[model samples]
Target chain A: MNPANGGWLIALTLVAAMLLGVVHLPETWPGWLGWLRPNWLILVLFFWVIEVPHRVGLIAMWITGLFVDVLYADPVGLNGLILASVSYLGWRFFERLRMYSVLQQCGILFLLVLGAEVLSVMVLGLGSERPWSWHVLVSALVTMLVWPLMFLLLLRLRTGLRVE
Target chain B: MSALLITLESSTRLLDPLRSFIGSLVSPIYVVAESPYLLTNAVGDVLATREQLQQKNRDLERRVLELSQISQQYVALKAENDRLRELLGSQGRLPYEVLIAELVGVIPDPTTFQIIIDKGADAGLSVGQAVLDAEGLFGQVVEVNRFTSRVLLLTDRDHAVPVRINRNGVRSIAGGTGDMGSLVLENVAISADIVEGDRVETSGLGGRFPPGYPVGIVASVVVEPTSAFAEVLVRPSALLDRSRHVLVIFTPQPQIESNDANTDGVVDLDQGEAAPATNGVENAQAGAT
Candidate 1:
C-alpha cells in the first residue's frame, strides 16, 4: 500500500483503540476489574511510536492526550504533558526499543506506563484534592501485560497489509 | 512545574472553551462506542421469554398504581403546605424541573468518581445542578460543556454534602471517602443521636442541593472513647455504579420583582424563603415523632 493509505490505516486503528479505551463496561462488572483495565490509548500510542516514530510525534500524542482529557473530564493539558513526555521518550528510543525482545520491551513499557500514572496522579493532585491510592499502579501492570498481544497484533496487520 | 501548576489552576477559564469544543466533537464517538452495549441489552430484552416479559409488565403496573395513589396524597399535602406557608408569610417550595439524560461515559480511574451525561449547557444545564437516579441523590454538575456535562459523584473525595439524620433531624456533613460504596460523616459527637441504619438526607444548608432528597444510609457508627468525634460510614442510597439513566434537576431562579414591597436590598429571596421552610419541616418532624 502507498504511504498515504498506510498512514490513514494506522490513524483508523488508533481511533478504534481510543474508542475501546473510552467505552463503558457493563454496570455489573466488579469494581476491582475496573482497576485492572489496561490503558488502551497508551498501548496504541506506544505501538505507533515504536513502529513509525516520524509519523506519530509529540504533537499527535499531545493532541490525543487532550482528547483523553476531554473524554475523562480531567484538567486539559494534564494528559497532554504526560503523553507528550512519554511519546518523546518512546521516539528517542524507537530504534533501541525495536531491537529489544518483547519481554524487555514490556519491562521498559511498564516503567513508561508507571511514569504516566504517577505523573497523572501528581497533576490531578495539584488540580484537585483527590486522595491517591495504590490502585493506580494496577492499571500500569495491566497495560504492561497487554503490550505483547498488542505488539503482535499490530505487527501482523502492518505486514499483511503491507503498510509502509 | 510552576507554569504547569498555573495552567492547571487556571484551566477552568483558559481550557474550558477548548474542552467544550472537544467534548462536542467526541460526543459522536461516545454515542458510537455506547451502541454495542445498548444493542446487546436490546437483544437480550427481545430474546427474553414471554413469561418473563409478562412478569415485568405486571410488576410495572403494580408499581405505577402504588405511585399514583401516593401522588394523590402528595398533591393534597402540597396544597396544605402551600396554604400554611402563605399564612407564615413564606414563599411556597418551588417545584423542580428535570431533564432525563443517559450516562455516556464514566471516568474509569478509581480515584476520580465522575460520570458524563449526554446533556449540557445547551440544554439549560448549569454548574451545581443536582443529579439523581431513581433511588435518590447521586451527585451534582461541577462542569458544564456545550453538548455534555460532568457529574462529580458523591463518592469522590472532593465532594461533600450537608446531610441530616432522618430520625432525629441532627445535621452533619457527609464527605466521600474515595472508596467504593461509602461516605464518611465527620464531627458527630459521641453522644449524638446517630445510629447504624439511620437514613440520611440532604440538609440543603449550602443551597447547592435541594433539601430532603435521600443521600445515604448509615452503615456503621464507631465511637472511640479516646476520640472526641464518632466515625459514621454511609452507603449512598442511589446505585452509584449501576444506574444508566439519571435526572438533572433544574431549580427555578427566583423572580426579580421590583415592587415597592421588595425595595429592601435582599440579595437572594430564595434564601429568605428557604429558612422558614426548613424550620417548619423540623417542627413537623418534631411533632410527628
Candidate 2:
C-alpha cells in the first residue's frame, strides 16, 4: 500500500476512536453504564502500534493522545503520556505481543489501560484532590473485554486497506 | 515530550494557547459525535403532530406574557431605585448582561457531572462565570476553549455554592453529593434556622456567583444529638439533567471597550444630529423580536 493511504487510514481510525471516547449515552441509560464504555483510544493505538511498529510509534501515539486530551477537556498531555507510554511498551515487545492469542492480549491490555487510567487520575490529583472511583479500574476491564472485537475490526481494516 | 508538555501546562499557562488551538482544530469532532442526538431531536421536532406544535406554541406564548409582566414591574422598580440613588448621591448599579448559550455536549463521565456549552472564550465566557437555566442557577464555567467551554454542574460532587435562605438571611454552604437530584448543606449549625421548604438563593458571600439567583430549596433537615451540624439537603431548582439552553452572565459595563465605543458612538449621534430616532427604532425591533 502507498504510504499516504496508510497514514490517512491511521488518522481516520484515531478520529473514530476519539469520537467513541467522548460519546454520551442516552439519558435513559443508567449513569453507572457510562463508566462501562471502554477507553477506545488506547485500544486502537495499541492495535496499530503492535501490528505496524514502524508506522505507529511513540510520537504518533502521543499526538493522538493530545487530541484525545483536548476532546475530553482533560489536562493537556495527560492522555499523551498514557499513549506514549503504551506505544513505547508495544514497540518494545511487538514480537511477543504478536505471538500471544487474542485472549492473552486482552490481559496485557487490561494492565496497560489500568495503568493509564490510574496515572491520569493521579496527575489530575496533583492539581486538585479528586476522589478515586471504580470507573478508573472498571473502564480498563471493559476495554479488555472489548479488545477481541476491536482487534478483528482493525485487522480487517489493515488488510482491507493493505495498510502495511 | 508528554512530561514537558504536562509540566508547562501546570506550572504556567505557556501551553494555554496551544490548548485552545488544539481545541479549535478538533472542534468538528464535537459536531460529528453529537450528530446522532441532533438528528434524533430534529426528527422528533419534525414528526410532532400539528396539535402538539400548537399546544407548545401556546404554552410558550403564555410564559412570555407572564415574564414580560414581571419585567415591566422590575423596570419601574429599577427606575425608582435609580432616582432614589441619584437623590442620595450614590452610584447606580449596572444591569447584568447575559448571553444565551445552547448546550453542545454532556461530559461522558457520569460521576463528574459536567457539560460543554457552545459559548466559549471567544464569547467572553470565563471560568467561574455563573450559568443559569430559565428556572434557576445551574452551574459555572470551569474551562474555556475557543468555541466551547466546560461547565461543572451544581450537582457535581466537587461543586459548592454559598447560599442564603430566602425566608430569613441565614447563610450556609451547599455542596454537591454527586447526585443530580440533591445537594448537602455543609457545616450547618444544629441550631440553624433552616427548615424544610426554605427557599435557597446565592448569598454573594464568596462573590463568584452573583446574589439573588435561586439555587435550590431545602428539602429535608435532620438534627442530630451527636453531631454539632445539622444535615440539610437541597433539591436544585434547575433541571440539571435536562436543560438544553442556558444563560451565562457577566458584568459587561466595565469589560469590553469595543462595546462601550459603539454605545458612545450611538449616544453621540443621538445627541448631536437628527438621527431619525434610530435608537427608538432599534428598541422597538428589540422588543418585537
Pairs that collide in candidate 1 are none
Over B159-212, each residue of candidate 1 has an lDDT whose tens digit, in order, gives 778889999899988887887699989788999999899999998776677889
Q: Candidates' DockQ values?
A: 0.42, 0.50
Models 1 onward score TM values of 0.89, 0.87
- Model 2 segments beyond 4 Å from truth? B80-91, B253-289
Count of backbone clashes for each model? 0, 0
Weakest ten-residue segment in model 1 chain B by summed lDDT = B279-288
Give the number of the best model, judged by DockQ.
2
- Error (Å) of candidate 1 at residue B176 is 1.2
lDDT of each: 0.78, 0.80
Give lDDT: candidate 2, residue B285: 18
